[model samples]
Target: MNFKHLSTSVIGLLVLSACQQPVVHIYHEGLSDTQRFQLKQQLEQQQINYEFTELATPDKYNTPHLLYFPGDVTEAYIQNVERIVKGLGFDRFDSQVFSHTGHYYTKGNLGLYFPSAYSERVLPELLFAHNCGDQDFQIHIKTNGQWTAMNSPIDLKGLDLKWEFYETFFKLRRYFDDGTFQQQVYQIKQHQVRTLQGYKPAVTYEVLGHRDYSFSLFNCDLQAIFAD
Candidate 1:
């Protein structure tokens, strides 16, 4: 091999590799000193190129930390950064992408919001499904003296229930061929619980209502509930 040509090829590969590397800018406020040290160590361990700038004032975004990346970055880079920050005891962080044109946009952003250390307790959520097979049914939940209709694979988070101690009454209406609905009601108590992770379904309640139809509840992981 010609030595001159080999040297030129090595230089070209190095340039390409450097261009592909992602540079991350971390803006943080309200982070303890130990947390900051751990974050830096994690970033260095991952060989991630990063810069830390302490915000003189509280972050306008109103979050503990924010990770800003270039618009051309990839998902792998984003995940690595998220894993590092979350490992540092920050359960929640927001991320955004900045264009080369100096404009910020939310397109293709993760927009993840997890429960942080600030929250005293995680409110239990309800997730339920029916064993009626192909039969279509309507569900409504009444809490604090108000009733609202709901859909199956029911999640109480979307129902906007008050974050306090209360009893939720579920109404299940299963339609039959006779143009009538077989209705049943279920009562479940709700409260908050302290958890290492975020809020999850407290318990799986198997409600045996009508002879032909019944529904059961189960705990769902955060990923399953938040999957796009």
Candidate 2:
């Protein structure tokens, strides 16, 4: 979905919803397997200068730490991030957003995208169609201490992922009349999940909303906190 055009409006809404919290922007794109390997090398090599350890396995730093994330996220990618986060004794919190090629379930204030003038509810239904088989999602937390994001009481150590988007098809399938039909049906494939291996974690930060969603770290520096 060409959210680029709606970016401004969407961000404005999200900002309004969480006026008291900071915003930590994370940007990333999918990479091929070969590219991912190359990126990993680059990140590991730069860790020294960045004063951060690569979130890698084999105890690269010989530190005893745990990396936590939602099981819904691919294990390979999660492990990749875990390695680096654990290496720094950093806690990982993930609220897996369901995004497909055409549609996505990001922050609700960001709204949803669809081809036709479908109802707002259609957004979640299509975005999570793939996960419907499992009917769940999770909030993963990996922390050395029992610290939790305020107002978010589902202890981070571990919890079963569960989120079932309401399922009710539209009155009429609008594909016949909509050019965006194809995009609407698009989804992020399993292979796309593997591509995340190449991404790097940024500094620790917090993104506050009505409920604090602790993605605090992602593709960019999370250390930069800006309270609204």
Candidate 3:
């Protein structure tokens, strides 16, 4: 088979089709009236463009608790990938594709993701945006009866996040940056997009604790929070 002769769109379509995961439900238990109202208002006003996704509990059954501006990631990365797909006229995460400067929360380093997994390359430039600390999304959470906006959240201070939020550590351990890695992982597996179960958090306070960084929310039964 001449993969070299295949079209980029065809390759992209193949990868998209091969993706099979159940959809999870986004819960409202974490959001208060104010947060919900503010979120909706922001979307209507176009004041911000972001992706929001929360996971459910039990480590067996996962759900997406919420989502907003779903794929509205910084357009830089999207444009870069789209450009290459156009030039090569092929669209496989495989082969020799170069990802240009893109953005997650903002424009930073670009990366290349090869289908072979082994050939996936992460140049120094791609790690630039993640070499620093976290400045969480402009979202709010209610803890102790107060609605606080998480513009630049503090680690180990999980605040109002439920158990499922903690599980993200292990579920998508592929990358761990300030908080970008976990957040991106959650967004990709959004409940509104697919139906899947719990993958669990494997990060702890030792050994690979460097990744755990400032998050200390896994100390309790995240699922039990909903149970009680």
* Number of the predicted model whose lDDT against the real structure is largest: 1
lDDT of 3 by residue, 3-84 (tens): 7667876987887744421121222223333333544454435433333334222221122211112343345534543343
Compared with the true structure, model 1 gives a TM-score of 0.40
Runs of candidate 2 with Cα error greater than 4 angstroms are 1-73, 99-228
**Over all chains combined, what TM-score does candidate 2 have?**
0.16
How much lDDT does candidate 1 score?
0.43
Ranking by lDDT: 1, 3, 2
C-alpha-based local distance difference test score of model 3 = 0.27
Q: Kindly give the stretch of ten consecutive residues in candidate 2 with the minimal lDDT sum.
A: 219-228
The segments of candidate 1 whose C-alpha lies over 4 angstroms from its true place after superposition are 1-3, 64-71, 99-228
Report the C-alpha lDDT of model 1 over 32-93, residue by residue, as the tens digit: 44555777788799887766644343224444433344555567776777787666554455
Estimate every model's Cα lDDT from 0 to 1: 0.43, 0.26, 0.27
For each of the candidates, the C-alpha root-mean-square deviation to the true structure, in angstroms, is: 15.3, 25.0, 20.8
The TM-scores of all predictions, comma-separated, are 0.40, 0.16, 0.16
